[model samples]
Target: MLELEKVTAAYSGSKVLFGVDITANKGEITCLVGRNGVGKSTTMKAIMGLVSTPSGDIKLDGKSIFTLPTYSRAKAGIGYVPQGREIFPQLTVKENILLGMEANPGVKEIPQEIFETFPILKEFLERRGGDLSGGQQQQLAIARAVVSKPKVLILDEPTEGIQPSVIQEIGRVITRLKKDMAILMVEQYLEFVLEVSDRCYVMEKGRISMSGRTDELDKDRLQQLLSM
Candidate 1:
């Protein structure tokens, strides 16, 4: 339900993304895979309207949202768990999650199902967000996003610095999310991305160089492009 059409973005006058195009459909997972500094994250930032761009069209459910502010984008059903799982350090687990509700308009109550996807959060409802382990914080980040009940979810490297078991848990949660939300991610874990995503886009030098159905991807070609 999200489309990035020939997007080009930059800092000051220097551009990074050049005609970058990617799409994520409802109840599907679309992944962006690339080595470091290839503009994968930049693409997401553009979609989120975190950076002003010279040209592009970013649409959510067929509505033009490119010129909107980041807050407006979040209100329009985009939930983003950025790289590093930027949870509020001092806020109690319950309080941290409540912040997500700001994105909601008429919603009056928290979803009990938020705890269903993340039972760990229920037990530590009063704990400080910074006091939790990395995995717990990541889970909290995802749970916080879920509290908003977004139509599209964008996770930036959810597995970057966590234990294997938590990574597995995150994988399971994402699997379940794909049953409803349009999920998109920029991840370094190729196997994880392939296992969870329906389609993959490989970026190189700030552009999509290869992409296809995850199961049919050419491993060698992807490996070569990733090494560049």
Candidate 2:
């Protein structure tokens, strides 16, 4: 589980998140959705310690992790799949996945579940990451993150640039993964978010403006917010 309380973050002295508060509970998917430049990605960055949070607290399982470095946060059970999918282009697929285990040094091999979640990865183990299609690369990114068995998985725009069929597969994978770990995602695709998320938070200008069970939120209103 992850919680951000009154989290105000900035990049180079310009604040982006303003008094943001959100929570991701174990065994559920929590989504943060909003238009561009509204600090959705910054919220994820703040949680990962990739951005500076001058004031506020980030907690994992009730303990504060605001002071932990990015690596420490990953080691502390946060597996992040950044917005761009950021996989190493030159590394072999297996090598890219193996990098995820840097946080869990004791794990000797890629867990079987990773292959189970993504059978395509098994066939592409020796292939260069850059050689894969965008969807395959996205699956590779998710595989790398989940291989570490993170308690809270942060996925930023998992559907971005992915094909429709791949998006459906990713949705299924996300639904399956939520049975084990807390899932927090930043997504602009409303249909995908509604299909997979248990709860939703609508952010506007760096603050959470609306939040509720996914089915309970006003779909038309959400569409309006995203359009603005």
Candidate 3:
């Protein structure tokens, strides 16, 4: 399991997260949901070591990773697919996927499983990443992350600006990926959250205000929390 215990983070002099607590277990799909500027993405950055957490601990399995740098954290099995699908625009789809291998030493080639899961990638291996549509780029981003064979995958707002049909495909891909590793995603779309998340944590003003199994949350109550 990957866990953040009372994690507090700041940017320059402004605090964004306050004693935030959440966990993502292997084989489960956990989601961090909240409105804009509520610190969902900040929480993801904190886990990935892109931001400093001066007052809390981040653990992978049972070990503390608070002091590890971003590259070290990736070596520790934390794969991050940041928002906006930050693929190398000038690189081919195949090259972009290969870039993830830098995190995992001794990995020589893209895994056959990745191609099996995202067949479209096989068809467009030579295409530049920037040439693909938003949905295709999203798939390539995910494929890049999983190719590193991390124990946990952190995705930030993956469905944003994606088409409905592509959203469905990404949802299916996430479901399948959860069987082997933990998936901790920050998402804004409520319907997608309700469908894909096994557990949900609702963040408000830099803190977690509500969390529970997806089936346990009453839709009306959830709607109210999200709207607040």
Candidate 4:
């Protein structure tokens, strides 16, 4: 399991998260949902070790990773796809996916199953990442993370700005991924969250204000919280 225990973080001396606690268990998708700018991305960044967690600890499988750097955290089994689908635009599709292998040294070959999961990737192996459409880039970003075979996969707003058809594909991918690893996703699409996630944590002002199994969430109450 991946866990944040009273995790607090800041940027340039400005605090963003205060005692934020969440957990992602293996074989499940744990989603964090809220209105924009409620420290959702910050929590993801802190889990990825991209930002400093000054006051609390992050642990993976009961081991503290608070002191590890981003790359080290990746090596320790955390795969993160940040907002904006940050793939290497100049690199070929194959090269960009292969780059993720560097997190786990000695991994010289891209897994064959990855191509099976996203067939479009195999078709565009030689194409520059920049040439792909927005949805394609998002797929590539997710592929890059999964190719590493991390214990926990963290995604931030994966459905944002994506086409409806591609969003369905992404949901399918997320469901498949949870069978092998824990998923910590930040999502805004309510139906997508309820459809794919096992648990949902609603965040407000850098804290989890409400959380429960997706099936248990009150429909009208959920809509009210989301609109706040």
Candidate 5:
């Protein structure tokens, strides 16, 4: 499980997140939804220690990770698939995934479940990451993250530019992964979020404005918030 309590973050002393609080429990998907520039991505970065959070705490399980470095956070069971996919362009698919094992030095081999979750990656193991399509690259990113068998998985805009079919596949993979780890994501695609998420947190202007069970939230209000 992951919990962000009264987390406030900033860039160059300009505050972004304002006392944000969220919880993602094991075996469930918790989504953060909001329009651009609402600090959604900043929240993820703050959790990962990629940005400075001068106040509040980010806890995995029950201990605070706010003071840990980025790599230390990864080692502590937080897997992050950043918004751009950010795969190493020159590395082969196999090599890229193998790099993920750095988070867990004791784990020498890529997990078998990774291939099962992404069969296409198996066939393209030797192919350069840059050569793969957008969807394949996104899949590769997720594969790289989950290969570490993290306790908490964080995805930023998983469906940003992928085709619809791949989006569905990613959704299914996300849903399945929840049974093994706490899943948290920042997404704007409401349809995909509604279909796969167990809970939703609607953020506005760097703060959580509303939150509730996905199905229990007022759909029209949710839609209206996203539109604005």
Candidate 6:
């Protein structure tokens, strides 16, 4: 499990997350929902150690990792797909995915699992990342992240601004990914979050205002806070 205990993070002394606590269990999907800038992305950053949370402890499977740098944290089994799909625009899809394994040389050859899950990527192995549609680029970004097979996978708004059909395909892929990895997703799409997540956290102003299993949250409460 990936756990953050009373984590607090800041950018140049300006606070974003205030004593945030969250857990993403192995083989489960944990969803975080909030309006833009309520610290959903900040929470993801804290967990990934992209931003320092000096005051709180971050643990992976019960050991502390608060001191680890971002890349080192990836070495210890964490992968992040940032808000924008940060694939190399000039590189072919196959090359972009291959870069994910730079740290582990013995781990070679793009796994068949990744290609099967995102078959379109296989078809476009020779295409440049910038040439694909936004949704297709998003898929490539995810495929690249999984090449090293990290235990914890994070995605920040994977479906933002995509067409409905592509969104559904992405959702299905997320479901399949959970079978082998822990997932923490931050999204604005309410119905999609409810459909696939095992549990949800409602964030307002950097704190979890309410959280529970997807089935336990009331419609009225979710609508009111999300509309704020």
- For residue 222, model 2's alpha carbon misses the true position, in angstroms, by 1.1
Error of 5 at 146 (Å): 0.6
Give lDDT per model, in order.
Answer: 0.89, 0.94, 0.92, 0.92, 0.95, 0.87
The residue ranges of model 3 lying beyond 4 angstroms of the native Cα positions read none
In candidate 2, which residue pairs clash? none
Deviation in Å, model 4, residue 94 alpha carbon: 0.9
Tens digit of lDDT per residue, candidate 6, span 158-224? 9987889988998998888898888999999999998989989999998999999888889688988
Backbone clash pairs in model 5 (N, Cα, C under 3 Å; residues 3+ apart or in different chains), count: 0
Best by lDDT: 5
Error of 6 at 46 (Å): 1.3
Task: Summarize candidate 2's per-residue lDDT along 91-160 as a digit string, tens digits.
Answer: 9999999999887777888898888889999999999999999999999999999888889999999999
- Candidate 6 residue pairs that clash: none
Residue-wise lDDT of candidate 1 within 1-228, one digit each (tens)?
Answer: 999989999988899999988999988889999999999888888888887678979999999998888999999999999899999999999998899888887556778988888899999999999999999999999988878888899999999999989999999998899777899999998778877889899998878988888889998888777774
Every model's TM-score: 0.97, 0.98, 0.97, 0.97, 0.98, 0.96
> Each prediction's Cα RMSD?
1.1, 0.9, 1.0, 1.0, 0.8, 1.3
Task: Compute the lDDT for candidate 5.
Answer: 0.95
Cα TM-score of candidate 6: 0.96
lDDT of 3 by residue, 1-228 (tens): 899999999998789999999999999999999899999999999998888777899999889988998999998888899999998999999999999988898689889989988899999999999999999999999999989888899999999999999999999999999988999999999999999999999999999999999889888888887785
- Candidate scoring better on lDDT of 2 and 3: 2
Q: 79-181 in candidate 5: lDDT tens per residue?
A: 9999999999999999999998889887888888788889999999999999999999999999999888899999999999999999999998999899999
Clash totals for all models, in order? 0, 0, 0, 0, 0, 0
Clashes of 3: 0
Model 4 stretches with alpha carbons more than 4 Å out: none
Report how far off residue 50 is in candidate 4 (Å): 1.4
Task: Give me the overall lDDT of model 6.
Answer: 0.87
